[model samples]
Target: MKKKNIIITGTSRGIGYELVSLCTDAGHNVLALSRDAAPVSGLDIDNCACFSCDITDKRDVAKVSEFIKEKWNHVDVLINNSGYLVNKPFSKLKMSDFQDSYEVNVFGAVAMTQVVLPFMKKSSHVVNISSMGGVQGSAKFPGLAAYSSSKGAIITLTEVLAEEYKETGPSFNALALGAVQTEMLEEAFPGYKAPLSAKEMASYIMDFSLTGQNYYNGKILEVSASTP
Candidate 1:
């Protein structure tokens, strides 16, 4: 496969960082965005560019869009991976928490997609990262009202975008990740056992993004080690 220009959000750590590494290793030009602004070691910085921007902030997301326009003019794939979670019982959860979660998980992804769509070619793909909690509500785990709702919103958004853009050329899909060993999961379930690693999840994500198949568009691709 030829080296394609790819942009991913929330690459400071976790699955986003792993995606950057794997994509670069596969000979794709990667542009990563995060709020932390730290660089990942080992990847060639020349071929891979990292930018610091809070996706929740429309102004900051616009700056990233402008940067991409000036730098590459187009992108072959876009991964909306930035997200936040606040695990608190629905009654105890503050309005601010809900707002913040939606701002990052839903609106942020929408903003970046709006900006990047114009620059994407006909074969471009857009992947939104969600969670298994979004697919099925968990009575077992307590205090996930805000986080789960935000992820649920993403899944719906993916479906809406896919239908809206059906004739527009680019494919849209959502990935409902299950128990990955990431900082977010560690924070949610401290010392909890996870079945998959970031690297493992990243490999599947990259394949879905670059394969040029429409099987996943408008559908939720669940990722889990034990899942068949």
Candidate 2:
């Protein structure tokens, strides 16, 4: 496999962490970003670089951009996986809830794309991690109004970017994922079991990042496993 340069957000835990591990273990050049100062333990020191950057903050993003500019001239893949979820009754939801969700889910993804576009190769792929709750009129779940709405916006963003950049820029796709057995799901729906695990999702995401990106541009794919 050819070595590729990749950038991924939300690397502190779950899918992001697993992707960082899988890509770096495969000897790819990966720059992992998380909101806090947490070291990704047990990885080749030479290829794995972790940094703290809230994707919503452009200043922090510029710092990351500068770091990449110093070493490589082009990025092969960009994954916008940083997201914040607040599950509460619609009536109880506050402005802060929407703000936080949009900050990371929508604005942060946009900011990351903007900051990295110049560094990306023309044939690069941009994958935005969206959710099934964001899919219009899908399985109705309470307490996800703000979170789903934010992701919905990204689903459209993916389409528009894909069209706008079809001739000149990279491919864009949004993976609207179903419930995986993640800490976020556990917290959001206590006592409910999901059909798959975070590692499972990460594996699929890695495949999409590396190869599926070539064929799945401008599509919002709803990924899921058959549940009992």
Candidate 3:
């Protein structure tokens, strides 16, 4: 496989953390971004760079742009894997909870894409990591009003972006994921056992981020085997 320059968000743990190691092991140059960079930075992989980034913050996003401008000039793939979960009943949901969800799950991905678009070419791909809960008519779960709705917005945003950039370059797609064994999953569903492990899901995402654009764009893929 040809080596590519890849960017992934939320790399401090779970699938994001696993993806960083996998990409480096595959000989790809990876830029791993997260609010806490230590987990990835500690890996000390040869082809990986870790940056502490809160995607909702402009200054942090600018750092990513500067790093790309000075280092990798071009990006082959972008995985918007960062996410925020607010698990609470709708009756107890606060406006800040909704705002926070959108900021990280939707707006942050938008900001990252905008910053990286200038460096991507037609063959490049942007994979937006959404959730199964976001899919229309999918298994509905309680305590996800803010989280699921924010993910749904990301799915729509992916479609809109693909249309806007169809003729110019890079393809965009959203992956609505099912339950995976991750810290975030534990937060949402307490002791529930997910059928898939983080590394297992990361492997799928890594492959898709590299090749899915060749067959799909402006699409929402429901990647799941279990409900919730």
Candidate 4:
């Protein structure tokens, strides 16, 4: 396989961390972005560049653009994997809670997509990481009103972007993932064991991010072993 340039967010831990290792193992150039970049940077991989990027911040996003232009010049894949979750009941959820969720889960992805699209080619792929809870008619859970609803926005954003860029390039798709044993999952459901591990899920995502656009675009594929 030809070496590709890839960018992934939320690389402080969990699936994103695994993705950095997997991409580098495959001999691909990777840019690992997270608010806390120390964990990934400490790995000292030659092909991976770890940056402290708060996706919601325009200045931080601009820094990413500068790095890409100076280094790779073009991007093969971009995984909008950064996420923020608020585990509070609807009645107890503050307005700021909803804003914060949207800011990170929705707007952050939107901002990344906008900045990266310019550097992507016709065959490039943009994978948006969403939640199964975001899918309508799927199992709904309490205390995830803000988090889930913001994820739903990501689903719509993916579809719209796919349509908008279908004629040009850079296909867009969303993965509505089920529960995985990660720090975020522990926050959402305490002590509940998920069927899959973070590395397990990252393996699937890494494969899809590289090739799924060939078969599908503007599609929401549910990646889960169990419902809810």
Clashing pairs in 2: none
* lDDT value for model 4: 0.95
Q: Write candidate 2's Cα lDDT for 32-64 as tens digits.
A: 998863756445458878778988788898887
lDDT of 2 at 120: 75
lDDT of 1 by residue, 1-228 (tens): 988999999888899999998998888899889998676534556678876888878888888778787788889999999889787788899999999999999989999999899998767899999988788543235688888888999999999988988887588888888788889888977897788888888888999889734565688877756542
Give all candidate RMSDs, comma-separated.
Answer: 2.0, 1.5, 0.8, 0.7
Q: What TM-score do all the candidates reach, one by one?
A: 0.93, 0.95, 0.98, 0.99
lDDT of each: 0.84, 0.87, 0.95, 0.95
Candidate 4, position 81, lDDT: 97
Candidate 2: 10-residue stretch with minimal lDDT: 36-45
CA displacement after TM-score superposition, residue 41 of candidate 4 (Å):
0.5
Error of 2 at 186 (Å): 1.9
Candidate 1 ranges with C-alpha deviation above 4 Å: 41-44, 136-140, 226-228
Work out candidate 2's RMSD over C-alphas: 1.5
Error of 4 at 58 (Å): 0.3
Tens-digit lDDT string for candidate 3 (107-147): 99999999999999999999999999998889878899999
Worst 10 residues of 4 by lDDT: 183-192
Tens digit of lDDT per residue, candidate 4, span 1-228? 899999999999999999999999999999999999999989999999988999999999999899988999999999999989889879999999999999999999999988999999999999999999899889998899999999999999999989999999899999999999999889777999999999999999999999998999999999999955
Positional deviation of 120 in candidate 2, in angstroms?
1.2
